[model samples]
Structure formats: structure tokens, C-alpha cells
Target: MPSLGLKGADLMCAAPTSLTLVMTDMRLSFPSDEELLSAIRGHHIGDQPLCGFAREFGILHEQLLETAAAHAEIARRRDELAVEVDTWVAARLPVPHPNASLHTETVGRLLDRIAEAQVHAYRLLMTISPDDPRVHAAWYRLAELVDGYTDLTREVIQRARRLPALGDRR
Candidate 1:
């Protein structure tokens, strides 16, 4: 009778100079085509496959192209959103004094604060549902921050404009 303890064969290929021992613990796994395709799909970015082998299968061409197109569409949408956000911010914020570094720095800090508030609002929205009361509150807080920054920036720019040049006589 065959030994019941033996689940698989211990493969060994011997050479004159060296010997390689293969065991069950060191078994190699070749994933199925479906599994490979699925993995490739899951991790692909910006129209490029994470794994080079994703292009090996002929059947995967159409699927890969479709996935790449989807990624490209997502990228395009993100770019559009970025442009919209910049335009929105520019519309709301006061322009800093051209020759005043202090005015620019003050405005820069206010912008940073606004960006932080926006990030907080975004995170809250992501964590909670759109209809949640907290989501609305977060958005309100972000708007208030921006409004406050706008008021403060206007004051700073006005103050900077009123300051006379250092070498000028009164």
C-alpha cells in the first residue's frame, strides 16, 4: 500500500556540481487567467498596468483598454475639478499687495488656513453621509473661515497700501 502520509512528491533535480532540493513548502503558484486579470485591473493606474504580464494574454487587450480609458476619464475629471477650485478661490480671496512681502505672507497664511478648513470639511463629508447635519455644519465652518480670511486680507492689503515708502518725507 502507498504511504498515506505522503501528500505530494518531493521533486529533485541533481547536477554534477550542485543539488537543488524542492519541497511542498517551496511550491510555486501560477495564478489563473481570471485571477491575473482581476489583480491587474485592481491595481492599474493612469492607463498603465502595474504588472507587465497583464499584456501577455490576448483576451485582456479590450479589457485593459477599457480600464485605461476609465482611468483617463477620472484623471480628466480631477483636472477639471482642480481648475474649478482655483477659479472659485481666486474669486473669493482678496488679491495681495504686489510689492509687499508682508502682505503676501499674511494672505498666504490665510489661504493655508482656508485650505486646512476645506480639508477638514472634505474629510467630514467623506466620513459621514451627504444628508448628515454634521456634514452641513462642516461646510458652514469652511465658508465662515473663508469669509473671515477675505475680510482680514482686505484689511491687510489696505493697511499695506497706506504705508509710505521708507525713504519718502512726509
Candidate 2:
């Protein structure tokens, strides 16, 4: 879908028409837990993040939240991580957004946008003098939290992905 102020089919005109185009144009496929962690760490500030952002594209399959009779852990961890990430990010916001206006974003984009804010926080800390222990401490804590997020997300990908072995039983 187009973003706010984006008009017509042009929404994706600038965006690549396929995954291959995205990988070739910016080489930012998630492809692994490490890359996602790097994104969470705010390392990719250029077209890479936009491309890496593409990694998030098809990763949020509903199967990732599957809760079968045999695999209760899938559901449990998904719910746990969802709440944990949301609560942790909410707590870190410098100030809450006042407007509750409607949005057209997909769930993945919403999550990505929040993660971007966390990255922005790191950006702010980086600009501060390193001599200041206070900001560095906060930055360290944020990094740790982002690591935790990466772990949870990786687990979701590993166990919850709808492999052929898993089938469509759920």
C-alpha cells in the first residue's frame, strides 16, 4: 500500500517490482538473524536500511504464530515476544504520539517503524560526547534490549516458519 501523501500506483514506482530487484538494487535481504540484528543495532543508515527493510517483507507469515497441539511453544513464544517488544519499545519512547489517527500500514511495517525509532534513539546517543557515561549507559541498555528482540524474532523464524515438514496442520 502507498504511504500517506503517496498517490496512485506510483507508491511502488520508486520501489523495486520484485525481491530480486531489491536485492540487486540495494542488496538488503534479511537472509539471516545477524543482518536483522544489525538493523536493530542501527548500523545500516543508508539505502541498506531501506533494502534491509525489505528483508522484513515476507517474513511475517501467519504460520509464524502457529499454535498446534504438538507445538505450543510456538504460540507461547510468539505472544511473549510480541508483548515484550511492544512494551519495551513503548517504555523507551521519549514522548508518546498524541494523535490516534488511522493508518494504512501493514503489521510488519508498524513493527519496523517502531524498531526504527529505537535505532533513532541510538543515533541520538551517538552524537553525544562519549565522555558522558550517562548516555552511553542508556545506549548500552538499548543495545541489549535490541539483542533480546533479535533473539526472539530469530526463534520465531526458526521454529514457527511453515516448512513442508510442519505442513499446513495449524
Candidate 3:
């Protein structure tokens, strides 16, 4: 319950370095774009030759690969941050914190952040060209994920409100 209490807030706060913090280190430096691409290539693509489809799009492959790497890196970092936040929340929030409004307020703040991130992602997606298959593909994937996050955040907020409504927890 403490995790649900804070996991979304932290994830909502720093899901990516873009979402917020750079858990890679306190130096605030992120891996270079080239480094991220290389890491992805080594793990997944692994000497896979680009087909004629990629050749047709030229630079599209580069952008798509970078975007994919960024996406995966963000997801990875979010999980890392969640573990850290969970540990802190477990200590502070406990089984029944002195105030349930804390849960409600934290979750409410998280909901707002999730909504903002989703809206920002959607606005950027709209600015992209529909005719461009490469970008649209990435946009579609991102839009789907953000929408899901928005839904999940809403659900968490609703559940958190229940603790307060139950009487003593509040």
C-alpha cells in the first residue's frame, strides 16, 4: 500500500531523466545518444542488417532507433527510481500514516503530473506529420503508453482517496 502511495508519485515525478532525475548518477549526466544507441544495438539488434525498408527512409532509421533507445532507457530508469522511492515510502508512510490526506495529496499531485506528461506527449504527437511512417510509428507507441499511464494514475488517485474516506485513516 505504501508503494501504491508513493510509487506513482515518484514514477510520475522522475520516470525518465526527462521525467525528472538522473538516477544514473548524481552528476546529472545522461548517457550520450550514441552510447544509448550502441547499448541498444548490442543487446537487441546485434548485427542485424537494415533492410530495404530502412534504406528507403534514410535518416528515419537513425531517429527511430534513437527514439526507441530513449523510450527503453526511460522505462528502465523509472523502475530504478521506483525501488528507491518504495524504500523511503515504506519507512515514512508506514501501514497507517498519521494522516490519510498525505496519501490523497501525494496521489493527487501525481495524477496532475501524469495528466500533464500525457498532454505534452499528445501535443507533440499531433505536431508530427502523419505521412511520415517512421515518426508516426514511434508516436503511436508513445501515445498508447502515455494514455495507459494517465488511466493508471487516475485509478491510483481514486484508491488513495478511499483511505481518507474510511474514517481513521484520514
Clash pairs of candidate 2?
none
CA lDDT of 126 in candidate 3?
70
Q: Could you give candidate 1's per-residue lDDT for residues 58-144 as a string of tens digits?
A: 113233334656656544433333343234333333334575443222322333334445555666777789899988987788678
Per-residue lDDT, model 3, residue 97, is 27
Q: What's the distance in Å from true for residue 21, model 3?
A: 23
The candidate with the higher lDDT, 1 or 2, is: 1
Listed in order, each prediction's TM-score against the native is 0.31, 0.32, 0.27
Ranking according to TM-score, highest score first:
2, 1, 3
Candidate 3: count the clashes: 0
Please give, for residues 47-152, the per-residue lDDT of candidate 2 as tens digits.
3333234223212222332324534554454344444333432232222134322223222333443454454444556677766786666657656654544443
| Residue 150, model 2, lDDT | 48
List ranges where model 1 is wrong by over 4 Å: 1-108, 160-170
